[model samples]
Target: MSKTCLIVDDSSVIRKVSRHILESLGFEVTDAENGQEGLEKCDENMTDLILLDWNMPVMNGIEFIKALRARSDGSSPKVVFCTTENDVEHIREAMSAGADEYVMKPFDHETLQIKLKLIGFD
Candidate 1:
């Protein structure tokens, strides 16, 4: 069966691009505009992967991941922070918050494929 992926980013362009890439890789994709809405989507269905963004309104990626990790099945979904935050500290923070991987913004199909493979999703 195809795996499920959730793209949680505030930008509609990012969500649309991510959805296309993930679907091309054989994943069933969904999206939300912010962290709170992303959590709502998770509550409705079991998501296998989450492409999360760092900065957003109404709950950032770090806060969202922390809250998610507090849930019963929070660890079930592998989270990958897809954002413009490329500093070492940011990467470390994401890892500390239960992110399985980190991908910089404006990722292409091949790049995303490699990252997903590293996380055992590709």
Candidate 2:
């Protein structure tokens, strides 16, 4: 079966671009406009991987990760923080929040592919 991926971001353009890239990579892609919606989606149908953005209106990526990790289902999906927050401290904080990897915003196909490969998705 094709792996499922959820792309969570406040930006519609980012979600669309990520959906296109993930679809090209053979992922069954879904999207959410913010972390709260993303969490709801995840609860409804667990995804194999999550490409999460750091900032949003209702809830943020770090908050989402914390809640996700606390689920009783023990569904440990690979989470890659896809955001513009490139500071070292923020990267460390994301890692500490259970992100499996990090990708800066404006990432290309190659950069995303590398991150997917690192997470054993490619």
**Whole-model alpha-carbon lDDT for candidate 1:** 0.95
Give lDDT tens digits, candidate 2, residues 1-122. Answer: 88999999999999999999999999999999998999899889999999999999999999999899889752579999988988999999999989999999999889999999998987
What lDDT is reached at residue 114 by model 1? 98
RMSD per model, one decimal: 0.6, 0.9
CA lDDT of each prediction against the hidden true structure: 0.95, 0.92
Query: Which candidate has the highest TM-score of all?
Result: 1
lDDT, candidate 2, equals 0.92
* Per-candidate clashes, comma-separated: 0, 0
Best by lDDT: 1
> Which pairs, if any, clash in model 1?
none
- Judge candidate 1 at residue 68 and give its lDDT: 94
